[model samples]
Target chain A: MKHLDRREFLATSAAGIGAAALAGSFPALASAADAPSFRPEKDAKLDLLRWTAFVPSDQTIWDENTKKFTAATGVPVSIQSLAWGDIAPKAALAAQVGSGPDIIMGWNDDPFVYPDKLVDMTDLVDNMGKAHGGWYDNARSYCYDQDVKRWVSLPVGCTGNAVNYRKSWVKEAGFGEFPKDLDGMLKLARVLKKNGHPTGFALGHAVGDANSWTHWILWAYGGKQANPDNSIAINSAETVNALEYARQLSETMIEGVAGWDDSSNNKAFAGGRIGMTMNGISIWYNGKKDTPDIFPDFANVTPPMGPVKTHTVSNNFTSAFVFKYSKFPNAAKEYLRFMLDKPQADRWVTEMKGYVTPALKAYAELPIWTSDPNITPYRDALASAKYDGYNGKPGKAAAQALDEYVIVDMFADVCVNKMAAKDAVRKAETRLQTIYKRA
Target chain B: MTSRSPLLARLDSPRVLGYLLITPAAIILLGLLAYPLLLGIWLSLTNATIGKPGEFVGLQNYATIFADPIFRGAALFSIFYTVCAEFGKLILGLALALLLNQQFRGYRASRALMLLPWVAPTVLSALAWLWLLDPQFSAISWLLIRLHLIHSNIDFLGSGWGARFSLIVVNIWRGLPYFAIGYLAGLQSISKDLYEAAAIDGADGWQAFRRITWPLLLPITTILVAFSSIFTLTDFQLIWTITHGGPTDATQVFTTLAYQRAISGGQLGEGAAIAVSPIVFMVVLAVFVVRSVREK
Candidate 1:
């Protein structure tokens, strides 16, 4: 080779190296080219407030990804995790005060509550949707603002809810597999109770567990909290039917479940006090990590079909929204984009081990779903799930209904108080009407 | 001494000095107590949610909440909880205080140990009670079962009445130490001569307690009750930790309901209304306490 000038030699070497790297990993390079949704601001440091992770790996993997983002973009980030229930109040207070964490990972319809205070993520979301397999329907319902026609938040993954049961106990109850219909499941519950292996579901003000199962039961029976026209519809015959079904189901469950909180079922199931309960992957994951004998004997299945169709709800449906007050909105958006990118998103979903179902559709093809039979059912949670305040908008009214435990109380009224189903429906309708009417 | 400036001389006046002396306290009261209380009242009068600067809607929030059965239920429960808890704390606390007032071994140690429940963080103690009240694994339930007193687990938090009772019991447990220690202080100040005189006049133990101990202790008891009633009426932590106002809202109180509505439900105005509704009752109690103190 000829002896080139210093500038010429450096230029030639840089071009050759770049070409080789791109060719060797073309897809990675292509994704990298599309990575930054916005340029990082000068001296950008970010603070993110997120709910404490239910799965330990979720926190670890998220922190690792966050560190990688900082390394790549030279933007520092601090993460603050609080109990899941606390995120809503803190986020609301942050919005009210116009200062706090630059970004908040909020649950359910949190973005809806303060859409005006959030930085619009429509551009990032639309681009991500097209690059990925598009957003899940429930994700849009949660993060999109119809009035403003903007994406107020980026949809994070959801914690899927499934019926975690002891396989041996279910088999002993004369069911080879978990029942797949409402009637069959109720029959199994009765049999399990008789066999001294009672079933349980939260009937108290368990913000997550109670709301998940109660909403599913109501929807499965074709009862809607509000009609699509946004009219109150919870006092219908369908609601009464749902109430009756819930009361029957509660009868076969272990006593005192009516007062159970979010952690109660996990404790009860892990200790073998109950044969089955409706919950997320935590119980099974805990058993797998801590109790080998229990882990092998446990199994999970999607909730049984109801009269209308098979319906369920996830315990956690979260979204990340950047606050308008954030001085580094670009950096915040970029961080979310980096996290949701295929490489990181795929890694997150895989490592989560079915604890979190992906919000984007592309990751549904990840091998993690097929790697374990138990993990497979969670993949469909977002697809099968309906957003809160279904039929109507999952807006402030519905959020109020959910937080007030309206649906849970409706079922509990009949099951625990021995109130007539009609009475329970009427009470719930009055409460819902009060909430929705105000809205 | 050198002649002072007119401003300094004026400031030395009693009224000026009184105002000057109280300025810091007034500022503290305004910043800490008055501001929040006023803001809460103002918010209750408006239709404020979380993010929006809401429009004033007068008593619309109050109207809405008053019409709500849940609010009505909470109001009733708050009173029931306060009355029951105060009564239980008073009886048990007075008994313990009377016993502690006697000259005994480990008197100082026992007095300090009595403060454990009160001094420990409420959340931590409530959590301990939560474990004890667990429907399935409750140590209390297990003991009762082992003794063949019951066939099945007692769902301490599962039933409406059971949850209500459990909450009251926990409240009493935590607050008893405060009442006992307070009454003990009053008991120590009482002249032994009164008891001695009553005994010489043919009074029994109960008679001496009714005549001498009762009259002198009334002021402190009233003050203690006033403080505790407010604390008990507005309690959130122990109940939230234990039941979270569950079993069909049997244990719902104003604070929890307000939290559920305002913060969790995002209806700040309605929540503020629920929160401030109890102010009327609290004011009456405050006035009564002040009058009692003055009379004493």
Candidate 2:
């Protein structure tokens, strides 16, 4: 104004811009500050343990979002990432010892396994649901314990499984597109095998991929692990049919399908070894980034429908539990609140490139799904995605069965070991009875 | 010097001093090893889950495990894996030790390089083997296929027997260097005069090995085999990392089975029982080994 120095003029302009930015976000800032439920402890610090993201960009997005929380509130958050399989046992040990991180994210039914040791987060759930247009049915079922009337964990997003296939290979195998039904899928698999491009999914103790697909197939064939009352209902004609169908399908798959884990198919597909496998959008994302030449060759379709019905299992449906032993429960809750807020959640969803199917209804309109046709199938799969216990409520028994690979072993017995389907079903039934009949 | 009390003087005596010196180590062992062993035994007897406190079930877990087929299978497989891997390692290690003991070009360098497999971290080496034996994209498979030895990739870690074979091969590969290096040290210690004396007495190569080399290396070999057996019997990381006792529990050894029961299945008591079941066998074997070694 009056021949001001360069430093003075620059500082004045920066202050003016800062004020304008603050004015725009003042309402949100004021509301957060005024809300009694949002109050954090005076010196709250948090330690959160979560599974390491398969996609590198997802981890980047997670780190960036957590930094925003630390910037907003002067609280430092430490995030410990571990392998997916390690999370359950580690969380169990922590609960048993009555000491661990403040918040630990695990698979569905993890809360039921140690509900007594976890803090009831129903208030946080109610608040999030009210703000985000209510939780999805599968999400609610996975996180809520109706008998106890407590939300032991907060329902977060689930990763949807779909058939990631090579478009070129499918065309070469005389299929213009992916199979829409299980019969067509089997034909396609056989043709792919004939064409030197076999299709496969994990048949072994792969906790995520194999379990999800095997359970989906069982449910599709009208076989249920338990009835509505949660009694053992595994040994049935429907289960035998499912196992037989799986064995037929296994013939079309590669020999090593019995040893495949959650990442095996992804690697196979990305390396141009297999024609198709059921997985999340991570494979597509990986191919898109690392193998750009083959990126366009990759495409995704929803899991094929079985003879009786179309049913698929959501591998993602992860949730976070705040232990009762947390010294700073409020801080953990507030951190989760900030992370699940619309803007932050949308950013994470966007960064994940549709790999994370949102649990909230409001996130259905995220631009990532609308912008890419490949991602829309995953978004749609979320609507019909079923939890671990489809007909029965997910509880400690179901969790234990899943962890023990009882269902996976049943399928493997028929497919890999060439055991009779009936015998396999009986084996699974006996195991389930032992688990559910326990006091 | 100031006069000392009888009690202090007694404590300063060499015999008392020895016990006094070992007290710290004894306390450390009790805290780190002995207490955990006792707690594990107690846990094995209870019906503990992960988070809940278990009551005294009085060996019910043990009885249940003994009746379980998977535990039985794992026990049998553990012995098979240990005996087979130890046998392979001993033979290969002896061959390597004898070869390396001879004078040759780059002998020192070759000897050092031979230790790479044993010196490298087990987990890292196991991961490398996992890649090498991967059903798809395995370098070894590629080589074999290229050589027209096989029409397609071998399912090295897919089948039960294939996985067992792969694990034993890896174990032998890792353990051979240790045995070779140990035997080499023993081989070097055998004086040249003894070999010359044997030669002067009309002893051929086989006779020299039988009379002089075998007797001198017996102590080292016995100790090495015993140590290797204990380690191989309780092996977890190699099997866990490669197969995770999978393909229908084919590769399931004692430790992996215990892990599956206790940690993954949340049946801590059952897992502990499976883990401690091998201790009795190991203890008896140890006693037998000690008696045999001492007698010789």
Top candidate by DockQ? 1
- What DockQ does each prediction reach against the true complex? 0.79, 0.57
Q: Please write out the lDDT profile of model 2 over residues A356-377, one tens digit for every residue.
A: 8878878888889878778887
Instruction: Say which docking band candidate 2 falls in.
Output: medium
Q: What's the lDDT for residue B73 in model 1?
A: 92
Give the lDDT of residue B128 in candidate 2.
92
**lDDT of candidate 1 over A1-439, digit per residue (tens):** 1111335423543454477476663232234434334666779899999999888889988898888777666789999999988899999999999999999999998888888899988877877888788888988888987766789999987888988899998998889788888989999999999999998899988988998888888888888888877788887888888888898898898989888989999999989989988888888889887777788998888888899966655457989999999998877887888788876778888888888887889888999988877887788888888878887876778888888888899889888899999988888888888888876
Residue A166 C-alpha lDDT in model 2: 85
Summing lDDT over every window of 10 consecutive residues in candidate 1 chain A, give the lowest-scoring window. A1-10
Clashes of 2: 2
Best by TM-score: 1
